[model samples]
Target: MVYPEQQLSERQRYYNAKEIAQYYRSRPWVVIWRALTIVWLFARFVLGLKLDEWFNRAELNKFKRAGQLRQILTDLGPTFIKVGQALSTRPDLVRKDFLEELIKLQDQLPPFDNALAFSIIEEELGRTVATMYRQISPDPIAAASLGQVYHAFLTTGEEVAVKVQRPNLLVSIKLDLYLMRWAAGWLSPWLPLNLGHDLTLIVDEFGTKLFEEIDYINEGRNAEKFAKNFRDDPTVKVPLIYWQYTSTRVITLEWIHGLKLTDTERIRAAGLETDAVIKTGVISGLRQLLEHGFFHADPHPGNLFALADGRMAYIDFGMMDQLAQPTKEAIASAVVHLINRDYVELAAIFVELGFLTPDTDIMPIVPAIESVLGEAIGESVGEFNFRTITDKFSELMYDYPFRVPAKFALIIRSLVTQEGLALTLNPNFKIVEVSYPYVARRLLTGESPEMRRRLIDVLFKNGKLRWDRLENMIAIARSDQQFDLLPTAQLGLQYLLSEEGKFLRRQLLLALTEDDRLHTQELQRLWDLVKDDLEPKRLFDVALSSLRVVSTEGIAAILPTANTINSL
Candidate 1:
């Protein structure tokens, strides 16, 4: 099998020899890091850290042992799991067997020091810990690489979990990431080494994203957004954040002590319907991404807790995902096509998303989709292996040259993760089978207005109609539209779809419903604006500004005073 030299082999457009050597010196400590990660796996599993003398005599599945090791790696905390996750996607650069082991890693972790937690709370609240919390826990109930969370009672008697950045976390992470970034850039272009990618680009994205995550203030805003998005449903629990107590490095949210999905035996013992709980978990998460477009990117068993009320609580907003409206629309369309098994349409959707180059034949990727979706098609959502489908997609990058947008990749990860949680509680739980209604509604017709009303029925930062896409709405209303089975962007369909896109987002919000019909005058005005500026953002800016007066506070959020706000 002669493999032709691929595009990845092209000389690093940016990598330099000095930087290459710098990367290895700064970051290759990870070779030792990887070795230690593996050794830790062996100690926890093959060696049986807690196993007794009789344990060696008793036989158990080694595969299960491997899975346990992976869990421990994730529990070991964010850095290792972060590395594992990155490696999980770049199979071309790493060992397949190792990738398999890493894939099992859970993003959940144990809680850390109460003393440190107290310090964080005190610091963020700009007062003594006692002043911030009337009663603080003796120790942290949860801990991750970057933060430790403590359950405490506020002076007002509110039970809360205060998350504090691990001291100097940003400084530590940046040093290591800088090294890795340098190494990937320097080495990724070398033949027999590129491993089919510019490692630097991946590393660079991680740096930017990771740094954003360290800012608890940003994470708090994300949590607030998700909470609002899911407000219609009481079954979901996104603990409210105490914004006043939050800062760049500290966040305080409502305390939730509940069973993680992984506590299977406990869940069973509690007389809870494990299968139902798992399905709810799956649905809630799907609705978060598919419907809300903002989601907690990391949802391992640890981050998701089952409250006494049976609502699933999602924690750790540090790692979150933002889906641009276009990406969300594309995913909705792809999902619809996938349900119908219109492989050709699915293939073309991938191309539209820049996953596949124009010349790359969709024929090859078609079988790949079918091969993965084979057991999934027409099956109830709960009957198919969602994780397997996602893994297959990641595997396809090797066969075809394409760009898997990182945001979409995270969306895929979130889906696979929720599926894993469901499987843990009920092996028979099939995500694909259960997701059929969502697919059927989207592909066959669309979301019932009621469902749409439940969430995103309000105007946002700028009060405007969600999409007063007058021009296209008028076209459709006027019978000038042509229907095509193939996916075509409805310039009108595009705007009215997102809250930020709509002209009367605020009106839709005030009414809490979307009828989406634009009057003739409005359509004519929209058409004139559309003709003036083809850019959606510019058009939105004009409409939004026209709708309301820009306040000084709005400008403040956009251009926060440099000295007052720490430079990220």
Candidate 2:
């Protein structure tokens, strides 16, 4: 099971910005000419719009201007197209009209020459096309900014997709990045941009990720890693990478047969429940972000398919990102803070996560954060969606000192694109409604020590138990079909009996006693909630299974108490 990355050289395995800069520096004329053309194009459309605004001329149709901008990016080539796709998710930077148009950049770009694409595949793979594939599409089935995918069948009669990268893609992208980084330095002082972070750093961050995307070998490895992560999940599917035929410039993957998640009519006709599809997407997405931390950053409709068997298939693993352990914990905690409507703590988390500068006064920003998030969430979590929240938060960012960290750019893009896809399938889809159950289940299960601490923070305050929170978490967690009653109960019992549970034990004891008397009312309420799920047979089975993990002495110690309970 040697990975594709292991076959590549050191230079091919990672993005080397300095090497790219040096390579392009030897060809200065290429950069200068391209930079001039880009400047002219922007001056004609972007600067022209600003000029029109300053002179207070007749108002032009914003939608029309946005279309022109999209066309300009399309003409500019792959690098600009990628930038447009990134901007499509940034409601904070781009206006509504432009954002709508930039969304087209995801998969709507025109294809390159078919003959050239075919020739490149042959050259890169070092094989004649007729020998390698039994059949290949005469034209690309789908065209994206970086590459176009051709549906083909291997000589072995297996259906596959052959992806061919654009001609001179690295040369074009390198020149563009170098020029953009150079320009960011010169323009930062004069431009009226209010982004708190340095403009050049953003360009570098985008450059790093863009470099990662062009290496088809890296993408093959990404697909494998992602597949390994979801190995146990039956509801989600990742395309198998044909590593034998994969190279730096071309990749072959299992051709998925399904309708796009956005194709509602066909999806419903296939007898797939739209809500169930959305649930799978949301839950799988939560696992990627909150659990595995390695996530598919680009989840556009074109990259996601709804299979006939009701599984959601994710393709295009080139644009993926990972989160560190601390970052994962911070995100989970942020969700809790948001649910609690604790804006002050939420603002602090934002600062800690680099969304705000340390010197920024959070006190003045707290109420504004509350107002935006509160209005979106209101009394019902069902009302919340990423688009609505981002739109409002965009305004807040404009008025306040908040900034979008470069690392989080793809994160926001992934979430917003997912919600948009969900909305396309079911107009009434509420992401928060589907998301909270997964988060609640994760908190309740307490998979890690940090998570257990978070659960405790949510369940107790001032040395007192919050029975309502515990009950509500259970209610929400049970809604997930994957939630297992016996395992969760066993984990809870094990933790309660451990040394780390000393504080919780004291708190529970205190909670069960009042005025020198024991109160069974809360205990009875909890039992009533769990009784249906914990049938006698299930309990007996769980007890029998527990014998493997529990020592005989441990069981003997608890037997007398169990006998007393049976007698009662």
Candidate number achieving the greatest lDDT relative to the actual structure: 2
Query: lDDT (0-100) at residue 26 of candidate 2?
Result: 92
**Cα lDDT of model 2 by residue, 83-145, tens digit:** 787677455467878877987887778999998998988878888899999999998988899
Q: What C-alpha lDDT does candidate 1 achieve relative to the native structure?
A: 0.59
Candidate 2 Cα deviation (angstroms), residue 249: 0.6
After superposing candidate 2 on the true structure, give the runs of residues whose Cα lies further than 4 Å from its correct spot. Answer: 3-13, 16-32, 46-67, 86-104, 182-194, 356-365, 395-401, 514-521, 543-548, 552-568
Candidates in order, TM-scores: namely: 0.62, 0.86
Number of the top-ranking candidate, with TM-score as the measure: 2
Residue-pair clashes, model 2? 0
lDDT of candidate 1 over 25-46, digit per residue (tens): 6656754675466566657575
* Distance from true location, Cα of 540 in model 1, Å: 39
Whole-structure CA lDDT of model 2: 0.81
